[model samples]
Target: MKKVILTALMSCIFQFSNAQNDIRIGGMLAYGTEVENIGIGVNAEFPIIEKLTVSPSFIYYLPKKVSGVSINWFEFNGNANYYFLDEGNINVYGQAGLNYTNVRLSYDGAYSGFLSSAASDGRLGLNLGGGANFQMGGNILPFAELKYVIIDEGQLVLAAGVKFNL
Candidate 1:
C-alpha cells in the first residue's frame, strides 16, 4: 500500500516538472508547534500556464525528545497554485495540493519494548494557503507565505524565502 502511494507521487512529480512560466526553486526557514521545533522546506515550481504552477516540496523538522523518545519527520508534497495578481514585485496567489507525509522515529536511549516505541507511517495531506512575492532585484524575489495543511491535527506552516523566476 505504501509502495503504491509513493510510486504514484513520484510519477506526478516528474510529470508536473516537465510541464510552463514558473519559479524553478525556492525554500523557507520557520518555527512551528505542530512541527515540534524548527523546520525547513524547499520547493520547485513549474508553470503549467500563465496563471497556474505546479510545485513539489520537501520538509524536514528537527527531532523532539520526550520521555527518552526522539521523533523526526520529513514529507514530500506536490501542489498547484493560481496567481491572481502577478505584477511587479508583488504577487498574490492561492494554492492547493496533495501531500504525502512520511513520518519516522528514532530512539536515543533504550528501554523495554513497549516503553521504547517507534513506528513509520504515512498519511495523505491537503494544503490551502496564500503568499506574497516581493521583488528583490531583476529575476529574484523574496517571499513570505502562510500555509495550512489538513492532516491528523492540522499543521500550520509560516515560511519565507527567495524565489527565482524561471
Candidate 2:
C-alpha cells in the first residue's frame, strides 16, 4: 500500500511539475483534536487546472503519554481543492480528499514485572475541508485549513503555514 501511494504521488508530482508554473511547497504546524497533540508537517500543491489544485501533505504527530502508555501517530493526506473565490490576493477554496492514519502504542513492564508490549494500527479515511490562502508577495503565500477525517477514529485537524511559489 505504501509503495502504491508513493508511486502515484511521485508520478503526479512529475507530471504537474512539468505542466505548471504555480507549484507551491511549504511546511505547516497542525493540531489534532482527537489525539490532543501538536503535529508538524510539510505539503505541496500543484495546479491541475483553472480554479483547481492537487495538494498532498504528511504530518508527524508528537508523542503523547496517556495514563501509562506512550502513544504516537501520523497521517498522510491527498486532497483536491476547488477555488470558489479568488480576489487578487486572497483565494478561498473547498476541499475533499483521502486520509491515511497510523498510530502506535507502547506499554512498559511496570504493569507487572514482565508485561511489556507494543502495537500499531492503521486506518484509511476520507477528509472534507475548507481553506484560504493570502498571497503575501510575488512568491509567498500564507494559508490555513481545517479538515475532519471520517473513520473509526475520526478527528478534526487544523493547520496553518506559509508556502513558497516554485
Q: Candidate 2: minimum summed lDDT over ten consecutive residues — where?
A: 12-21
* Model 1 Cα RMSD, 1 decimal: 9.3
Off by over 4 Å in 1: 1-21, 108-116
Q: By lDDT, who's the top model here? A: 2
RMSD of each: 9.3, 7.8
TM-score of each: 0.77, 0.86
Candidate 2, position 63, lDDT: 97
Give the lowest summed-lDDT range of ten residues in model 1.
Answer: 108-117
Candidate 2 per-residue C-alpha lDDT over 31-135 given as tens digits, one digit per residue, 9 for 90 to 100: 999899999999999899667899999999999888779999999999999999989989999999999999999989876687989999999999999999998
- On a 0 to 100 scale, what is the lDDT of residue 6 in model 2? 100
What TM value does model 2 have?
Answer: 0.86
Candidate 1 structure quality by residue, lDDT tens digits, 21-119: 445687877555576677788888777755787878888877777766677777777888888997876888888998787777766344555545578
- In Å, residue 145's CA in model 2 sits off its true spot by 0.2
